[model samples]
Target: MAETMYDKIWNAHAIVERDDGQTLLYVPRHIVQEGSRFAFEFLQDRGLTVRRPRQMLASPQMSISTRRRDIEEITNPDQRLTVELLIENTRKFGVTHYGLDDPRQGIVHVVAPELGFVQPGTVLIIGDSHTCTAGAMGTLAIGVGATDVLHVLATQSIWQRKMRSLRITVDGILPEGVTAKDVILTIVGRIGANGGKGHVFEYAGSAIRAMSVEERLTVCNMSIEAGARSGMIAPDDTTFDYLAGRQFAPRGASWDRALRYWRSLPSDEAARFDREIHIDAATLAPMVTWGTSPEDVVPVDGRIPDPRAEPDAERRAHMEKTLGYMGLAPGTPVTDIAVDQVFIGSCTNARIEDLRAASAMIRGRRAVVPAFVVPGSTQVKHMAEAEGLDVIFRKAGFGWGEASCSMCVGMNGDTVGAGKRCVATISRSAAGRQGRGSRTHLVSPAAAAAAALTGRITDIRKMGA
Candidate 1:
């Protein structure tokens, strides 16, 4: 049978199908973040341990604490406890190798491909919604909750129902100032946020064909926001080229063999998807979020939506609340909105290519708002600094911060102040996300750069090459 990319990857990892219709899938790799500390503690308390104690302990120390019943509990515990528990647990049950800082320690999804943990035919799971980011590598990666995390940790597998396939084909060359961010945002706007619910998306067409692996990663990273279980682009030369020479990528003869294998992962032209969405890439413009949801977005030159004009009472009420929180008047021009900060980082846009694009725009321009850039990984940070990208940003009036999740979640002490609004490249704009009472307007790197210069939402096209 002709198979889609998802089918090839899913079948490769399928261990068994239960009578209940759920397939047991073997996980080739698993990733967790600081938020996973609770899961760790839960395991310890239950006497369930991890396999490969030394490997688990090798993970970087995360500085996170949780307040339980007014008592501060350190979730990570000491390295000794982490290692011992993992060793004990893995021995009791069984597990694949536990990878530490192994060059794949940043965001689980980002680090996985950078470190070659996600290959063309593999099943990857992580305790993060953005685990879909790995789908860019042609893998079937999905997010699981803490309970599922424990289950996978104990059994090295998890059960999942089959998801219908949705193919989103975007063709044509993108216009200036348009990007992968804009493409995904436009798709969300067209389909509405929940359009892809219960579906796995396969991105195709010339526009997708033109995207680099990093750009494709950004597109898939936000698939969850559109209610898709996951999203993937077929593996090709672009994918292999990006993976080649990476710290964890296969070399010499292995590289040739891997490339051959990756080429075979694409779907046949005759393969059929359960649903299809077609978009013209040239029609997409520089997009920005005007309200709390990713779907509350418009072109850079557009205006905020008026709830009073909405025909549905339920939708109107929702829009009214969003307008109030965003401090946006109905019909106010989105481009006229002023910003107090411009953040250019997050797993979505913090890659080296994103930094380079922002630097090019900010060069020789002083930021009118407090502006900053953060790399997605420690290695990315070092590479950018080595190439003098850091100097260009600092000279252009932006702060250069260490590699971490940074301003993406407003965690780690980096936050937008109360009542302050920011033009951010990060995903999500929920209330109090950047900080308590802080407002975020999501944009692309070019839009963020223009906003930094003018201290308002500005058309990135006007900035010029």
Candidate 2:
């Protein structure tokens, strides 16, 4: 029988299926962040210790201050405790941890893959929705809740229901100004927010193949926004190239063995998916979210939609409410929407490639708004500095920040002020995702940079990007 990559990985890890339908699967990799403190507490309450400490990776992410590493300087008591508790728990369990002072410390999703802890044919579970970012390496990555986190901590295996496979194929060449972030925003808009419920997505075809590993990570990072359980890309030359010299990837004879296994993991030619969608990449433009939902998207030159034109009463009412909250009026051009701030950092689009693209756009232009650039990890921060990208950004009137989740999660003191409009390169733009009463226009880093320069949602093409 032909097998999809998901089937191959799932079958490899599946231990036993119960009559009621839950299957026990051995997960080889697990990542926990500061938000996972409750799971640790639960484990302690149950008188348990982590079963496979070596397989677990821990970091303090959700609440760390991007400005300072000192615990006393964190300002928010809750945020400081999150970091302190994670350190205490990881040390007690003997699990390897990346502290704020560690060079490997970063957004957990970003740090794992960049350091090669996530690999092809592995099953990885994390307490973050963006864990699917590691699926770019052909890993089966899934996000879990607190109970599941505790389960994974006490036992290396987890119980799960099967996910149907949804294949999304994007063919044709992307336009010059289009990017991976734009591609994903377009996908979510076309499919709607709940498009991939109860399914795992396999992104493939010419456009996906052409994207660099980091770009593919950006595409998969937002699978959750599309209501998918997870998203993955099959391993290929690109995946292998990115992992070749990575810190934790296999080496020498082990590398040869791993390559052989990965080569066989892609779906067979006759493999069938439960559902499939095809897209023409040439039709996509740089997209921005007009309202609170990821599906409320439009091309750079598009206008805000009029709720009165919607045929469905329920949808019309919701659209009107969204627009009211966003402070946007019908027929208003998105390109004319002025922003008070700009953020260019997230697990979705904060790799070196994203930094380079944003820097190129504002290299000689000064930002009209208060724009900030936070790298995804300390390693990425150092890499940008080595290439002078940080200097370019600082010279353009953009604030260079330390590596952290920063304004994306909004609990780290880096937030869009109340009722302010912000152009962000993060994954989602739901109300209050950045801060209380904040309005977010989500776009690619290049687009965000263009907006920072113009103080409005200017088209990247118009800015010569």
Candidate 3:
């Protein structure tokens, strides 16, 4: 019997089938953050201790600042306390901790894969919704609530119902300026925010296979925005190559054993999925979200939709409300919109490749508005500096920030001001995702750079990107 990649991974992780049709899954690794404070407290109240401290990785991502080089620079007292609490709790339980001062410290999702803690054929979960980002390495990554956090803390495993599978196949070749970010926004737009609900999305086909591991991470990272349970790409040479020399990845003889296991995890040709969606990659253009949700997006050159013209009453109302909040008129050209700020960092688009892409556009140009260009992690920051990418960005007048989630999550004081419109490379554009009353137009890094240079929603293709 041919097994799907999802089935192979899921079955291998399943320890026992519950009579109620659920399975007890053995969680190989658990990524915890400041958000897990309550979970830790919950365990503490019951006199419980972490079952596998080494298998659990903890970090204070939510309270960490991209603006600060050291812990004392985090001025917000409450934030400082939250970070301290997380560190204290992790210490109390003996969990492997990555504090703000830790060189590998970063958003849980970004740090995990970069440091090689995440790998193919592993079942991992974090409290943050973007845990799906790790799925790029062919791991079954899921996001759970604090209660599930406590469950994993005590047992190092989780009980779960089976998830259906949906495969999205991207055909043809991507045009010169099109990016993984655009491709994902296009998918969410077509599928609607809830279209992929109740399923795991397997991103496949020629276009996806051609993407680098980092690009695949960007794609899977946003699967949550499409309302999917999770998203993943199969492990191939690209996956092994990316993980080859990472600090936490298997070394020597262990590496050989790990590689052999990963090689057999891809879905067989005869594997079946519950649903399939096909996209023509060549047809995709630079995309930007027009409304509060990711699905409310269009090509950069496209116009805002008229809600009254929509036949579905509920959807029409939603469009109208979102448009009202966005201060956009029906049929308004997206290019006509001007941005007040531009953000170029997030777990989704803050990788080295994305920074280089932005640098190509920002090299000699000055930013027309405030632009916050943050790296995804310290390692990324150092790598970009070693390549002199920081000089190009700083000379262009962009704020070169330290590594963390930065403006994407709107915490840590890196926020788009109230009522301000921003062009961003973050995964989500939901109202308040960037900050209260902030209107976010999600785009690729190149597109974001073009917007910052022009102070408007300009297409990267037109700017020669």
Candidate 4:
């Protein structure tokens, strides 16, 4: 029988199907972060213990301060307690915990993949929505809530409804200055935010195949923004090479055996998807979000859409309201929009490659606006510093921050001031995502870096040869 990669993996992990159409899927690996404390507390309250301790990894990211790695530096009492509780619970449950000061500590999604815990053909879950980031490794990764976390912790399994599959194929070569970030933003723009609801997106074609593992991760990380249950790419030699020799990846003979299974996990040539979308990578340009939603994206040189041009009255009203919130007017040029700050870091685009791209653009140019560059993980930070990317950012008048969620989520101290406009590499530009009353423009790291240099949104293609 022909099968998509999603179908194959779903069947492999499915233990039983209920009459209600939910399947009990076994979770081989789970990741928890600071916000997972409520689930842990619930388990403790019930006198239950983690069913599979060794299969879980705990880290603190969302609540930790990027200004300093020490737990003491966390000013907010509640946020500090969340980190402390995560440490205590991990130790009590015999799960490995990476504290703020640990060199291996980072955003859970970033840490898990770099440490090789994310493997092809496995089912992994995290409490964070961006858990799909691991799907870049060809794993079936899902994001669960607190109750689901408790269920997975107590049983090492989760009940979920089957999601339809959508295959998005991007052919042709990407143009210069275009990136995976731009590709994904373009997708969200073309397909409304709700277009992929209740579906799992499988990215394919020559363009996807050409992307490095890091770039693939960036694409999959924003799957949630498209309302997809998850997003993934079929594992290939590039995926294998990226996971090779990593801390927890299969080794020696196990690697050879794992490779065989992974090779068989791609969708069969005859497999049919519920839906398919095609994109021409060669025609894509760097994208920037003008409104609060990721779907409000347009090309760097494009103008803010006129609400009156919208055919649907409801959509036109929404566009007008969104423009009010964003402080953008109809027909405004995106390239001419000034920004108060720039933030270049997030699970979506904070890997080593992303930092290198941004640094390359900002080097030898001083930032006209206040800008910050935070790596996705401590290892990413070390790698960047070793490559002198840190020096380049600092010399360019950008603040280099430690690895943490940073301004990506306003829970941390780093944030844009009220009503201030920021160009960011984070997944969302939704209202108050960075801070209350703050306006955000989503773009690729290179675009964000260019905006920092110019104090306005500048087309990355225009910045260099």
Each candidate: RMSD: 4.6, 0.9, 1.1, 0.8
The list of candidate 2 runs beyond 4 A from truth reads none
lDDT of 2 at 437: 94
Better of 1 and 3 by lDDT: 3
lDDT of 3 by residue, 42-137 (tens): 999999999999898877666677767677877888877778888899898898887877778777888888999999999998988899998889
User: What is the lDDT for 430 in model 2?
Assistant: 92
Backbone clash total for model 4 is 0
Give lDDT tens digits, candidate 2, residues 249-292: 99999999999999999999999999999999999999999989
Lowest-lDDT window of 10 residues in candidate 2? 64-73
Better of 2 and 3 by TM-score: 2
Q: What are the lDDT figures for the candidates, one per model? A: 0.77, 0.92, 0.90, 0.93
List runs of model 4 lying over 4 Å from the truth.
Answer: none
What lDDT score is found at residue 279 in candidate 2? 97
Residue 202, candidate 2: alpha-carbon lDDT: 96
CA deviation > 4 Å runs, candidate 1? 51-105
lDDT, candidate 3, equals 0.90
lDDT: which candidate is best?
4
In candidate 3 the C-alpha lDDT for residue 305 amounts to 91
